[model samples]
Target: MSLRDRLKETRAKASDGFRGGKLMSSIFRPGSPFRKGYVDSPRNRSYVVMNNVLYHLHPVKVKRHGVRLSYTLCLGGLSFFLFIVLTITGIWLMFYFRPTELAYVDIQNLQTTIAFGSLVRNMHRWGAHLMVLVVFLHMSRVFYHGAYKAPREFNWVIGVILLLLTLLLSFTGYLLPWDQLAIWAVTVGGNMAGYVPVVGAQVKFGLFAGLEATTATLLRFYVLHVLFFPFIIVIFMAVHFWRVRKDGGISGPL
Candidate 1:
């Protein structure tokens, strides 16, 4: 046989060796999709989806239009990817940050003293900004495509909640730098919150903890930025994803 044929034969033999081995069988039960497209029946589909978390995130079958990049632009995926990037970069940044009266000093040190600290901090900051924009675009795409209608309405609501939570997460993180701009932004945001009707004063007080921004306000925002908001957003994102799958996988072009 020719060299090409020999290489193909060798590849086939190696594939078969694993494909027919006990390890493969142990990892993928009979009729598993991982086993040569065995998920051709309802029973196999259910079994594979139950066993595989990757399959659980996506539909067993998708329409040709639904898989088109032009139609969806993969905005949701991009948004999720940015969030993960932020999470990782944010964790790395936490080691150098101190959310106290010395917060600005810590930020200065982070940008100058540590290795790649400037790069990581910029990634965290820009990643947050990108996530917010991408999420908004994702929502807009859903609306333009009319994917927000009918059975997916509830998921749409969940998406809106996630958006709000994302914005709040960004806002909370904004104050961690503790510069003049951050303080001024907090004052403006607090003032804006005070316009809310019944609980306006209480809301403003809770936000800043007093008449003006203080170290306590920084601490509160830090806790919310690093802990509270992330926890809440993660829960909502899970529910949003589950509801999307239940609502009929990804919506196809109309």
Candidate 2:
């Protein structure tokens, strides 16, 4: 057997007979990162990174270039942070919102009556816009950095799916106010969807819930904005992060 394999066997035998036997071996497993500076060697370093709970999201022993501040310009991290902010602010806005025709009145009350309501609403609105930009920029950074090559190709597709979901979220929320502006904007958007070849009519109908936008459309968009889209985006985000770690962490600098 290889030296490393033999070493593993010896460690197992030793652990099987130690004071706490298997319990100690389980917690302190060979090369447990909790034992800091344990032997400073390649094998130990790899084991440390592999066994550390905190490394689940990002393996610390990454390439030298991946550590540079300018390498990614923090776009990916910022995009994720903005998503979290949007989620928090979105939830806060939800408590005061209604998807019916009274939605506009509810919005006005939020802005004029509820304490910090205007602030939170504005934060949610602007945060959504910023998240769209940030996610796009993050994708652009990945593309230019060649991080989308090879095994990361699937992640690139996931990122694109996320960006599209972000756009849909933003569009759906735009109608939550139930104002004339929202109506006109969505009408124009739906009309555009109606030109999409074979599924055009169905797409537009599905979007606005009838021949045109209505109270039903408002409720439909509301559910999609507040529930469906968010749930779908989150699932994609999890897989994207998992692929990042599995594909040997982030790619090195170009």
How does candidate 1 score on lDDT? Answer: 0.88
Off by over 4 Å in 2: 1-55
The sequence of per-residue lDDT tens digits that candidate 2 reaches over residues 96-124 is: 98899889999999999999999999998
On a 0 to 100 scale, what is the lDDT of residue 217 in model 2?
97
Q: List, residue by residue over 189-210, the lDDT tens digit for candidate 1.
A: 8899999999999999999978
lDDT of each: 0.88, 0.86
N/CA/C clash count, model 1: 0
Instruction: Provide backbone clash counts, one per model.
Output: 0, 0
Question: Model 1 Cα displacement at 247 (Å)?
Answer: 0.7
Q: Pick the candidate with the highest TM-score.
A: 1
Per-candidate RMSD, Å: 3.7, 10.0
